[model samples]
Structures are given as structure tokens and as C-alpha cells.
Target: MKRIRMIIAAAFLLIVAPLVFSCDTTEKKVPYFIINVKLDQLTYPVSSTNKLYAVFFVNFNWTTPWLNLSSSRLQIITPPLNIGDFPLFFIVFYDADNSGTLNSGDIFQGWDGVIVSGNNLTPIIVPETEMMLLNVDLDNNGIVP
Candidate 1:
């Protein structure tokens, strides 16, 4: 009788232990809001001092109204620049009221001007919101797309 009881208890513990340990009741997938950003011009030269512009459209269908759209950050990725090179600037626009026009105050500006003598350029995000126009001066004289 003692042997039979021991076997049953072991079997019960083996089955219950796995069930208790493997159960996950947490929520996994959190839906993210999608925003589409496009460049005004499709192409740019390798080395030039041309003005680059981009437009961003925020799709609020999946996003809640409580979410802060204006406070979100913007980023740009570029290659490493040579010594004493000028940084690239980015202008971001947001239509918070769903208006068809992007007004003067609707613009967000940022720049990446760090001179790193390497092959890869790190991504930089502008922390300021006052500047809207990005003036990118490629020091390498290479046309950047």
C-alpha cells in the first residue's frame, strides 16, 4: 500500500509541476501604431549641398487618442563623416489636427553632425522641436541619397 501511494503521489507531482510552471497568463502582443514617412525627392546625389525634404503621415486608426503623437521622436541613419564635415539635418512634419496643410509650426527639426572617421555612420535623433528645416552639408562631397 505504501509503495502504491508513493507512486501515485510522484505521478501527480510530475504532471502538476509542469502544468503550473508552463502556464503563461500574461498579454504578449501589444499593437503598435503605424506612421508612414516619405521623402519629397526620391533620389539625391552622393556628394552635394542640396536641400532634402521628407513628409510623414500618421495613421491613427490603430492608435488611441490618449497617446502623445507630438511628443514622439524622429531618427535618421547615415554613414560616417570625415573630419570637419557638416552634419545632415532632418525636418519632420506632423499633422495633429488632420489638416491637409503642414503649417510653419507643424515642423520638427533634427541634425547629425558628429565627425567620426569610420565606415559606419550612427543614427541620430534630434531632441529639439523648434527647427523645421534640415540643412545637410555632406563634407565627403559624395552625393547622399
Candidate 2:
């Protein structure tokens, strides 16, 4: 069968390629990464006035290779930030007045958390994903700027 033949060939490549390449002792040096965060598309805005104040936010767990033995913590961030070493990332897109600081006025927001591996993935292959946050404000107090 054609399918059977294809499977056998795939198995052969999988088995043989590693053996061929594994013999090389040279270590590979992988560079760090750069990321961009953005926000949009959420129905919950405390008020139209405050919705204008929201801004995007991000948090990333950074390591020099996630495989490294030591552990670390997540670093929250916004756009225009350059990250180095082994950067594992998650994105938060927010909407609130000032856009600089999250306040009582932020009515609606969107969020998505995904991991970005610096060593395993490359800049070209990395895609910037957007976030949509929930509207947590029940009272209408967020209207102030």
C-alpha cells in the first residue's frame, strides 16, 4: 500500500536522522527572543468612557532554555519591550483609560496565555497572538478618564 510505504519511509527518516546528527559533539548556541503584545475585541467595558483607557499587558516566564535545571518566575510587561535569554511568554491585552496604568475605569479586557519557547522556536516562526479580557466591573464607577 502507498500509505504503508510512506509510513515506513517516515519511520526510517525519524530513526536514521537522529543517529546521523547525534554523532556531532558540537553544542549549539541559541539566541534570545523579542516579543510584541497587543489588545482588542472584548464586549465588557465598564463604560465607553473608561474603555478608552485600557492598554495591552503581557507576562512571560523567562529562562535560558526552558530545559535548564533552575526555575524562575513570570515577568509582566507591555509593548516596545526587548526580551533576552530564554523567554517563555504569555500575552494580556487590556482596555482602560491612561493606557499606562490599569485602574477602576477598565471595564472590558481580553486575555490569552500561551507559552513561547525561545530555543525551540525562531523569530520568523513566532506569531503574535491577541487577547480578549472579560468585563469584571458590575458597578459603573469606572467612568473617570
TM per candidate comes to 0.26, 0.22
* Alpha-carbon RMSD to native, per candidate: 15.9, 15.7
What ranges in model 1 sit over 4 Å off?
25-36, 39-64, 71-145
lDDT digits (tens) for residues 18-50 of candidate 2: 999989686443333222323223443333343
What are the Cα lDDT values of the candidates? 0.33, 0.33
What TM-score does candidate 2 get on C-alpha atoms? 0.22
